[model samples]
Target: MFKEMKLLKPSWITALLVIVLSLLSIQNYRVLPAKEDIIFAAIHWHGPVLLTQTLLLCLIAWQVVSFRKIRFLVAIRGKDEVIQKNLLKLMTMEVIGYFILFDGSYLLTGHPIFSKGPVIIGILMLVLRMVLVWFLGLLLITTYTAPYPGLILLGVLVVNLFYHYVIEMNFLLIQYSQTYDPLWKAFNLNR
Candidate 1:
């Protein structure tokens, strides 16, 4: 079973996976109700949250598939510890990036789905966005030799940046720039 797997093989399939996942995220975002204010935007956090979670799940699947390939390679090519270590590190970073994305989205959207409190949500989200970007960087580096993978990573970066700057940041800025009295009164946050 492992013998059939190949590292950097089926590059188009991986690229397609990335595209499908991103489109799902964008679809979730697009479905939200339009509102002037971020706090009262009538947006349900579940869609985006679930979508992001799905992306993470896909990444895990990729990791497993890649591991199978690595195992096959190890068996035939004399067990390169460095490749294994690097793969593990990349997977770890991807997991960490997912957590950051979740926390950040939660905070930026004003805890729409879960009420985990506001203290660390923003900070975590900022870190998560950075981590997500970093994930793309790693993807680009790892898949640079493969045209499809590199192109897919580039596409993901473009989409992510578009969403962050055009949509997410707009809402965040609105949330931050407004007077606190109305927001505090609306959300019942004592401050």
Candidate 2:
């Protein structure tokens, strides 16, 4: 029965999980006034993480999917000549998994980033992040066939830098003050 059913290689899931785990990581610390109590920070969790590093994660996902071995590469070996025909399916699955796992963790932990957000905004935040990552993965993979891949990579780097400094889009994961959060009441949905 196991053989009859399709199973993905463990490595693909491993690589996808690594990205999710990294994003969901908590940054714990204590301020001078709260020295005795460790605080699980929302902004501190991923605030300092550079956008370039996020792009690197996308690149890593691309590289992992490009692996040739049985463990890293499977489920795309169709009779058709196009080896990457299932690339969209694979990327969509990875993004959905990334959203569910990370957001689910946020929901359970009551992280201020997730807990203090309105239901609609919270859902939108997850969706936007996943869409950007999915697009980046596809962009990175497209470069493989380009003649001057380095130039394209450099251009991508510039855009990421612009987004990091100018646009300043950080997955809407902000740390709202406990007492002043207008959306705090919406946290019931999280629980």
Candidate 3:
């Protein structure tokens, strides 16, 4: 089972995750606050958030990279065919997981960011992503080469950044009134 898994080298995977985790930790933090609550805030919450996002990103990235490894081009590539089929199956599971995550998080948190409407939208988007995988996988099958895998990877990274910093931050601000928030109530989303 371990050999059949075809995992990437542990070091390479760690390095990739570190890059993303570091970027996530650094973006849109200091400037977002007025006076630096840097010490207490970083000490209290940053580490946990960083760890959680790192793990989540790592899991998502693993799915992506693993799927890309399946070579789609060879007419007789049993390996590619099997891997692609497995990826499709895994993606279905992932979609269901996302829906559950969205629903559960929204219900428990009572945060606008995780509200039922957004959760439903997020679930729909997950389904859309799976559809994209099917179409993209078909393209790769016909071409036998993922000519622009980097493009898709970069796109996903950007989307993650927007979700984490922009969307999540807005939702969080609306839910919690904090001294750490910026001076302009106009800029703040607190309701």
Q: Could you say which candidate leads in TM-score?
A: 2
The candidates, ranked best first by TM-score, are 2, 1, 3
lDDT tens per residue, model 2, 54-165: 5444544455334333322233444222334344455456556655554555545533443444556545544554566666656655553455555655665565455544
Q: Looking at model 3, how many pairs of residues clash?
A: 1
Give the RMSD in angstroms, all C-alphas superposed, for model 1. Answer: 12.5
**What's the true lDDT of residue 142 in model 2?**
53
lDDT, residue 157, candidate 1: 53
Task: Write down the worst ten-residue block by lDDT for model 2.
Answer: 31-40
Once model 2 is optimally superposed onto the true structure by TM-score, how far is the C-alpha of residue 69 displaced, in angstroms? 13
Worst 10 residues of 1 by lDDT: 35-44
Model 3 scores a C-alpha lDDT of 0.43
How many pairs collide in each candidate, listed in order?
Answer: 1, 0, 1
Off by over 4 Å in 2: 1-81, 112-117, 169-191
- CA shift at 147, candidate 2, in angstroms? 1.4
Ranking by lDDT: 1, 2, 3
Model 1 stretches with alpha carbons more than 4 Å out: 1-5, 35-44, 65-76, 85-127, 130-191
